[model samples]
Target: MMPIDRERSDADMNSLKRTKLAYSILSIVLIVIGIYLIIRPQTAMLTVCRVLGVVLMFYGIIRLLGYFSHDMYQLAFQFDLAMGIFSLVAGCIFLFRTEWIAELIPAFIGVIVLIDAVFKIQTSLDAKRFGISKWWLILILAVIAGALGAMLLVIPLKVVEFVMVLIGINLVIDGVLNFWVVHDTVRMIDSL
Candidate 1:
């Protein structure tokens, strides 16, 4: 019984180690790809759009067929079905005419960032209601984010370079954060 318990414990430890290793690898890969997308926005966007479109189209078709065949089709779920079709159409447009669609990528990202920054800034202001000076950093970062977003709109040419640099900075930050988390988790697991 003692030997059996020891073997089980060893196996459990090995499994936990494997899981942590996998998570670390996955996090690193995601961060790398994110950085790559920012560096080569046009190409990455084109590829992602095309792939997404194809997947959405297929999903739509599958859902549409199920909707007709199944008696339990809900109206709310139909919205998802419609969205899939829309995604497919949008993807097809980008896949076929990437040059025109490519322009939309930067603009869309810019608008998203602008909205995000505005929200962050607002949250920071709201925090000021509590009289917190730390919120000032959030406000400053928000302004920087909005400025970077505006740069994309005001000067499209430089946006690519800015995006690349921003991505590099983000990746470094994310990598460091993830590394710390991974290290802590490993330590905790080992302590167990």
Candidate 2:
């Protein structure tokens, strides 16, 4: 390969690594938040909103970065650009209008998760085409997450605590699914 090409490849690899790391961090954060919600469903609404706002903003930035990174398969980050913008806007609303947003947070987050789950279903199919052995697992998890997200959307606001628990469960599952997909499918050139 030409020297310039090699340099570009190296830069791309570095960016990919950073993107993966950022994604991993975001996944971990989701798991932690999920656990928190599960354990303390009765926590103050404003505090929960603030925490979710920060997390959503962070996830948005990470998703944007991941979209720009050079993933070998290109499946993992395909929907990131749009999702990032959506997340950023949602985060802003949550932060600036916590009181107004508290009631709607579940539905908003449900939409985000549902969208991600749908994209992940596509990613799993692409992974199958690429001959990844664990693609079915991704498909199953994505389906489950999608169901959970749909439930969140339809559940009445009167059942806030139950909704919180469901959201926590969904977040945990989604986080694990994302982390596994990124680690399993996102390959550095040297590993190829």
Candidate 3:
């Protein structure tokens, strides 16, 4: 390879490593937050919203970075650009307009999760075609997460505790599924 190409390749590899690390951190955070919500459904809504806002923003930035990372397969982050932008916008609204968006938070989050699940479904299919063995797991998790997200959309805001628990379940599933997809599908190998 030319010197310039080698340098670029090195940079891409570094970016990919960082993106993978970010995804790992994000996944753990999601799982922890999900457990917290599950354990304390009665926690103040404002607190939950603030925390979620920060998490969503972080997730958005990570997804954007992942989208640009030079993974060999390019399957994991194909839909991340759009998802990242949507997450950033939602995070901003949740953070800046907390009071106004409080009651609608569940539905908004539901939309995000649903969209992610849909994209993961496509990713899983692509992975299957690419001969990945764990594709079925991704598809199953995405389906379950999608169902939970849809439930969040239709849930009456009157049932605050139930909504919180449901959201927690969805988050846990999404986190695990995303972690798996990123770990399994994103490859940095220069030679196929």
Candidate 4:
């Protein structure tokens, strides 16, 4: 008799592949923007900071609305509330303190890169868990991302242009890997 203890179905496989495809596409866009940043480091830093500030403020407004509008998971809701407030404050700092924030943009980018590297690794693992083919490729990409992120953090930002170059290179490579992931996901979907 065949064992009948598996959770995967065709639908699950399709869903997984689709999700990875979407994620890969998004990563590709971000990577392209990153390349632009590399090309114009100083200006890009200001733009990135401004964008972040706007995002934070928008997120804060959304979250703050949630408190009044709907019921949320208790723990998650609490966390959201806290984060919403924090983001609002942080956003204000970024917007109002442009000069100070400008000075810290490199550090901010480093921290963001480092954090994203950790998530990319986890995302790679998640793809593997879903039985995506050539999952190891994502793992390799994750490793590369981690190394690049670490370099951003560990290296001093004495020369802002140097930091930009590193970031640019990382983004270009990241974008390339994203496309690879997309291609692999598409192949997997076709096979399925």
The whole-model lDDT of each prediction reads: 0.49, 0.90, 0.90, 0.59
- Model 2: residues >4 Å from true position, as ranges? none
lDDT per residue as tens, model 1, 1-192: 999987876776665455445435634653665466566655455565454345435544443432332122122122334444554565566568766766665454355456545755665665565454455666676677677666556555456555545543343333333333333323222463
Candidate 3's C-alpha lDDT? Answer: 0.90
Pick by lDDT: 1 or 3, better one? 3
- Two-way TM-score contest, 1 vs 4, winner: 4
- How good is model 4 by TM-score? 0.56
Stretches off by above 4 angstroms in model 1 are 1-34, 37-43, 48-100, 157-192
Pairs of residues clashing in candidate 1: none
Better of 3 and 4 by lDDT: 3
The window of 10 residues in a row where model 4 has the poorest summed lDDT is: 69-78
Q: How accurate is candidate 4 locally (lDDT)?
A: 0.59
Q: What is the lDDT of residue 44 in candidate 3?
A: 81
Lowest summed lDDT across 10 adjacent residues in model 3 is found at 183-192
Write the candidate numbers in order of decreasing TM-score.
Answer: 3, 2, 4, 1
Which residue runs of candidate 4 sit more than 4 Å off their true CA positions? 1-25, 42-44, 51-97, 174-192
lDDT of 4 by residue, 1-192 (tens): 223323344444555445444445545665776777777777556766676577557646544543333221121122346545865886777788877887776566455455545655665666676676677787787688768877877667687778877877776666666466545533332354
Highest lDDT against the true fold, candidate: 3
